[model samples]
Target: MPEPEDSATLYAELLDSARRLSFDLRDCQTGTDDADRYGMTPEWSPLYGTPTWIRMSEPERRRLTRREVTHFLGVAIWLEIALQIVLLRRNHSADPTRPDVKFLFNECADENLHSLMFVGAIEQLGERHSPLDRVMILMGWVFRTFAWEEVAYGIVLAGEEVFDVMQRDWSIDDRVAPAVRRSSHVHVVEESRHMSFARQKMRDRLRGVSRVRRYVSAVLIAFGAHIIAKGLINKGVYRGLGLDWQVARTEIGRNEHHRMMFRRATAPLVEFLDREGLLNGLARSIYRKSNLL
Candidate 1:
């Protein structure tokens, strides 16, 4: 209830939330059925599927494809590792006075597992390209160095901006299985709370920093998030469905909705940065071009 700082309380909440969310999600966490739960046959894979199945690909996918919904689970794995590295290296050991910050660490473990399950779905794709390569590129230059607030905000925004809508409708996707749907349900419910907590933390913690620090971190965060999105959301799906992945991403970018959601998703961080006086001229130009405002 109190305004959060980079202190013990934040750690406490992070621990509490992580525990509840992790416990609740245990049912869907089992990876045994993940590969089979969907209609994932080689026939279902655009790679080897019947012409009829390939031809009948959904418009949303044809229009804005991503890897199997399950793969998102896997990508979540690297993200967790990346964040944990940051937390462990940067954690204020004495800050354990706050229950929330503890929650962040605890939740990080669960989130890591959740993301691994998602990534497992991706590995199932058997791409000519390595998802690990994509993961390394995104994590190194993008997510590695950031003000924790930006990382916190980015996670919530990803959930609230994109996946919030995605989780609900994916149940009907021929690509997703019932078990995965059950898992995603956990993500949807728990992440909704996580989003609120992350956003709240952003609002509370990101203030009062030097304007320069705020601006730098925001730009960095957005840049990093964009790279991951392209790799995961853009390239990952097209290839999974056996399409010309590169061409499809280019084509889908022309779609108004995806572009809009992207901008909207990253907007809060941008605005937060702007208020902190971090928007350099180049960053401003980029943000304007992003058309997220």
Candidate 2:
């Protein structure tokens, strides 16, 4: 458990971090257009290096990549919405006078802004409808009702960290669309603070947590991570492009480059979970299935 003073100091540092990273979205040029039609680096695509990718026409590849990026941001928006609800519920009864409580409010506001930015990107990229969007909405409502503090926070941490790795790449890669790259850069800057806060909260939640509880929490966390991993790109994307969604999903699974990227991206979080004894037993197996181990 963190000392009161320690927690307070952490919150102060987080507030400083947030202030330093903050930006006004109105000033950002969010207009995405035909010029922003480039695909991600081959390595970032699930079908990269596969026979399928080699056979794809340049236009088809570009369309898929653009749709995939749109889907990615769409899922991110959903995840942030769910996270905001979970965080709000966690802090529902918090002492408003505390610095930590104020920080929670600030974090919620940050997530709201992020949601807008993500929505803006999707709007600019032409919306791709997916059945998974409805599922995500239902899941968000269901998950919000339960204040599974440790489990919920762990999912948030895992999701953010995984995307942070991908976004870091896009933020610097000139080949990526300018709007996509700029949005990523903005998110990377702001989310660094949110990620720091989540890590601290996860650690605090795990401190002295019982083995039985840890076991249940670990499974739940892995399950959540798996859903998030699979949810990033929905079948609707492939279907919209006149391709077989099932085949695309299968090829993505067989794409070692994609699998390795997931494993590498999640390495830090997995190591942390293991050190905290939250990555043992069933949790480890589940992560392996998700290619996150």
Candidate 3:
């Protein structure tokens, strides 16, 4: 935990960073050679090293990558929209003059821009994917409606951290499409500020909170993480690629490599949650079941 003075200084720095940054969607336009490139890092693909993956032809693999990336973008779009609503709710009673409230508004604007970028990326890929299932949609409404304080910020941090780790790889990998790389690079740069703001808010909110409330927040956050990890790739992706969806699901379930990647991506979040006393047994179980531990 930061001292009061240190925390205030950090908040000022984060707000300044947010105010200084801007991203233009036009800058992420696809290039001529981008069509021939992968949409994300090949290693991050859920089935990357599986026997089925090894048997896939180049075109099949490329199509799978496109679908997977689009799926990720779609999920990101959903999360960003939810986050915007959550921020707006937070801002409803907040003083606009405060630096924290100002940062929240800035983050909402950033999230709106990010959603547009994700939509454009999907359009560029030209892949048709189904929206998230009804259950997840309902869950999202519940979260954005009722989640507050540490719970809300913890969910935001989880999504941003997971995507940040993956996008960092996609942004620098030469094999990824230029548009994907550019959009990812932009997201990584902007979301770093959002993540920091969320961490600071979570710490502030959790300070001197009750044990029961903390435990409840921890479980809710874990469930939120589960929803995010589970929703990233749609089941329709495998079927779209002309593979057996059932088999692909089974393989993904047992794919230690993909599980390891998930664990690696979420390592920082897990560590932070633990330090904040939000990593109780129930939370750990949920994270483990979701392949996020």
Best candidate, lDDT: 3
**Mind giving the per-residue lDDT tens digits that candidate 2 earns over 1-293?**
22367767898888988877687564555555554455445467777777778889877777778778877787787778888888787778877767777788888898888878776766666556455656666666766777487787788788888888888888788767766777888888888888777777777777787879988988888888888887875878888888887888888988888889999889988987888778877898899988888
How high is the lDDT of residue 44 in model 2? Answer: 76
The TM-scores of all predictions, comma-separated, are: 0.65, 0.92, 0.94
Angstrom error of the Cα, residue 207, model 3: value is: 1.1
Give all candidates' CA lDDT scores: 0.51, 0.77, 0.85
Candidate 2 residue 35 C-alpha distance from true site, Å = 3.6
User: How many residue pairs clash in each candidate at the backbone level?
Assistant: 32, 0, 0
Question: What overall lDDT, based on C-alpha atoms, would model 2 receive against the true structure?
Answer: 0.77
Tens digits of per-residue lDDT for model 3, 64-155: 89889998888888888888888787678867767777777788888888888887787787777666867788989999899987888898
Count clashing residue pairs in model 3. 0
TM-score of candidate 3 on Cα atoms, chains taken together: 0.94
Instruction: Report each candidate's C-alpha RMSD, comma-separated, in the order given.
Output: 6.3, 2.0, 2.3
For candidate 3, the lDDT comes to 0.85
Is candidate 1 or 2 superior in lDDT?
A: 2
Over 44-109, each residue of candidate 1 has an lDDT whose tens digit, in order, gives 222222232345545433222224444454455556566566655565563653555555655566
What does the lDDT come to for candidate 1? Answer: 0.51
